[model samples]
Target: MRILARRISVRRTLLKTGSEQVLGIPKSGRSRAITISPQTASLLRKHQLRQKELRLSLGDAYRDRGFVFAKESGDPIQINNFGQRSFANLIESAGVKKIRFHDLRHTCATLLLAKGVNPKIVQERLGHSDISMTLNRYSHVTPTMQDQAARLLGDALQF
Candidate 1:
């Protein structure tokens, strides 16, 4: 069940009871598919294969839940515990500062915006209600980007 694609749907969040339920984004109440890098897609494929192997090893004890990330017995990992237990260790091993799991979302948005990605695309990927929200949140203007914008503006006005 490996999917090779740039987009993954956000239809549901798995619960500890092995349930599939849709969860809307707070404030906006919108859910949308997120575009991912090919490298990320490949990583997800490998993770899925590993999960399948774990499930088969568990036999009758395994739950056939549809979570992209699940426990060995197919139970959903608790979000907070996942950060404190799993992510914290990974960050420490990588020698990165300790940051909350939720900060990843902000980092993703900031990186995308910094790379000159369109605000609308970022908004859709982040499930933001509007482009204005995306702009307000991730409008981190670097000196290089500002200089580039100025050059483009000068070129346009020269004509």
Candidate 2:
């Protein structure tokens, strides 16, 4: 299935349901492709190349899994393992507050919404069932955005 996110089109959905956990899919069961920024795309390409090199170096020992992100042995990494190990370590080293990896998704949605990206677009990118879900979940607006909204409303009401 082709996944299209606004103007950007990605080849396939990198993630799928697993035995331990199920990734949420839209109500329609259709995969939605997300278009990422050019910089992000470049980073992904570099990561894919590194993964390929690791796979070749490991030769037969590599698991040869399809998951985009995998352990050095090419084995799929469990969310709990990543969260408690890599993610937690990174947060601790960076001196950031402890937060679940899932919070990153919320942060992304909040930042995008506060930046004025259309709610519908954010919803599509997030693979939410509908725009209302996106609106309800990430309705937080920054103080700067709130001021901008007020100014825009005042201008509109000006005679």
Candidate 3:
């Protein structure tokens, strides 16, 4: 996890579409550079430290591993193999409804927009090349945000 300016370069999915059928990611596009809040950065840092400790415990056998969690055969880490099912089961056990992993990204965008973050900033953070993409995805802004915008304009006009 590296921070470059307001962007955070992370090893994320880079899928290609259409008939060409490219399975793997390119060197430049595979690594995503996105933005994150300070709190998220702190949490990720802590998680990385914990992962490092776990790797150390595994000794030289774990040296130069490509994933934070993976099989001994060196396949890419997957949530199904990394306790996601267990996590969902726990949530269900706790009376929560089923939720897909992709929902987290939607939730984050909704929260950011609700908090009055500029759409452009949100688009950049989500790695959308255009602001319209972000706007189209999160078209419904919270009522509280609208009220806040009105109040801000009123205050600005007071001068």
Candidate 4:
């Protein structure tokens, strides 16, 4: 499954079930594809190689259910576990504002919108059910967008 330039399809989500995590459909019951740069694709290829090496070295000891990111044993890291065990320590070490794991999604959307990617494209990338949801949820991040739009309008209207 060496998918190219990384048109990564997000199909399954890890859900906490009892003491274990199980793979299931996303909350919206939809699968979405996200395109990545060639550089990102190259890095992911390298990551896959490293993971393969680890899996081979561990032999049967590796859990190996095939997660893009995983623990040494190959078991998927539950979201809560990742936030509590890694994200918090990582933030403290990096000296950044403490942010919830879910906040990363917001940040990504905000950055893309700020960069002036079309709202429709952002909506698909975010798997938003509709354009209004994306626009409404991200309205705060678009004041700068409004300024740019006005400037462009002014430029176009110049005699």
Name the candidate, 2 or 3, with the larger TM-score value.
2
Candidate 3 clashing pairs? Answer: none
| 2 or 4, greater by TM-score | 4
Candidate 4: residue 4 Cα off by (Å): 2.9
State model 2's lDDT. Answer: 0.74
RMSD of each: 4.1, 3.9, 5.2, 2.4
lDDT of 3 by residue, 54-75 (tens): 6777777665445544454334
Q: What tens digits encode model 1's per-residue C-alpha lDDT throughout 1-159?
A: 225377787765433434444433344554457767889898888888898898889899999767788777787677868889999998989999889887787777878887878778888877777788777765566788789889989999995
Best by lDDT: 4
lDDT of each: 0.75, 0.74, 0.64, 0.82
Best-fitting candidate, scored by TM-score: 4
* lDDT of predicted model 3: 0.64
Judge candidate 4 at residue 85 and give its lDDT: 73
Clashes of each: 0, 1, 0, 0
- The residue pairs in collision within model 4 are none
Off by over 4 Å in 3: 3-7, 11-32, 68-75, 79-87, 93-97, 139-159
Provide the TM-score for each candidate, comma-separated.
0.77, 0.79, 0.63, 0.84
Cα distance off (Å), candidate 4, residue 1? 9.1
Cα lDDT tens digits, model 2, 78-128, are 877898999999999999899989888778888998887888888888778
lDDT sort, best first: 4, 1, 2, 3
